[model samples]
Target: MLRYTLMRLGIFVGCLVVVWALVYSGVAPRGLGDSNGMWVVLLALLVSAPISFVVLRRERDRASERIVQRVDRMKSGLEASRNQEDAVVDGTTGAPGRTS
Candidate 1:
């Protein structure tokens, strides 16, 4: 999970760098405005990246929660079956000291 987060952060940063380079090199126009186009693009990227990351992280957390719930339910069912088996064994044993 930490690795995945780091990888995603690296990709987001790389994208920002690429965008900056493209704008700086004049390969892409900044925008049709009085403000420096690069600054505007940068601002937008800065805002969007964190929001996107947070949204993705929230979704990942929800999915993890669901998986944990399912696993716990499965474990509980297994335990119940084991207990039932134990009860059946005790019933068939008849007397405590008896063996067949």
Candidate 2:
């Protein structure tokens, strides 16, 4: 996840630099008076989105798979704990707090 996030950020920053350069060089149109910075940032974001989506697809998938596995592990742990508690409450396990 961290890797993917960093990669995405890198792509955005790269686009921002390129867009800024283009605007500075008069190749790309600058926004209305005083809105040049905002325009550049927005354009960078727009350009980066698709680039990141395609370039980081593998990283994104790996991150998602890791997240899913972690969630599954948590769920299984909770189920096992619940089963143990149930057994203790039923007096089947020698839990310390059991009266019988």
Candidate 3:
């Protein structure tokens, strides 16, 4: 989870840097005071948002599944270890020559 969050932060900062560079370099056209640049930026964001959301959601789901599976395996291992210990105790106590 931490790694995913960091990865997203990195990507966001990278995009900001690239956009700032473009604007600084005057690569985006000036709109003759019409402010069409704002509209273009908004349109780009609207289009990119859903695509980024879908990709991130898929990654998060996969990571969650992996964590769940790992936890389950650890639980099963602990249970098996406990059962083995119980069996050993039972056998030692149940022998005819043994005293409680």
Candidate 4:
């Protein structure tokens, strides 16, 4: 997860630097707002999104799989704990003086 996040961030920053250079060099015209400000960031995000989608598919999938597995494990643990608690409350401990 962390690896994928860092990789995505790196790509975005790289794109941002490229955009900034283009704007600064007069190759790309500055638009509505200052290209050096939020405009550049938004442009970077737009450029990076597709680049990351195409280039980092494997990393993104791996991160998603890891997240799903972690959530599954957490959910199973919670269910088991709940079952144990329910059993105790319902008097199913199978010990002396405990009802089924």
lDDT of each residue in 1-100, candidate 4, tens digit only: 9999999999999999998888778887676754457777888898999999999999999999999999999999999998788778667656555332
lDDT string, candidate 3, 1-100, tens digits? 7766665655555555555556557785544566656644554555445545665786778779989999999999999998787778878888544333
Worst window of 10 by summed lDDT in candidate 1 = 91-100
Q: Compose the digit string of candidate 2's lDDT tens values, residues 1-100.
A: 9999999999999999999999999999999999999999999999999999999999999999999999999999999998787776767555556432
> Per-residue lDDT for 79 in model 1?
90
Per-candidate local distance difference test: 0.70, 0.94, 0.65, 0.86
What digit string (tens of lDDT, one per residue) describes model 1 on residues 1-100?
5555665666566767777776678886676576665575575577558765775776567667877999999999999998787778878977464333
Error of 1 at 73 (Å): 0.3
Top candidate (TM-score): 2
Model 2 lDDT, full chain set = 0.94
For model 4, what is the error of residue 95's alpha carbon versus the real structure, in angstroms, after optimal superposition? 13
Write down the TM-score of every candidate: 0.43, 0.87, 0.51, 0.84
Pairs clashing in candidate 3?
Answer: none
lDDT of 2 at 87: 76
Error of 4 at 85 (Å): 0.7
Worst 10 residues of 3 by lDDT: 39-48
lDDT-wise, the better of 3 and 4 is 4
Candidate order (lDDT): 2, 4, 1, 3
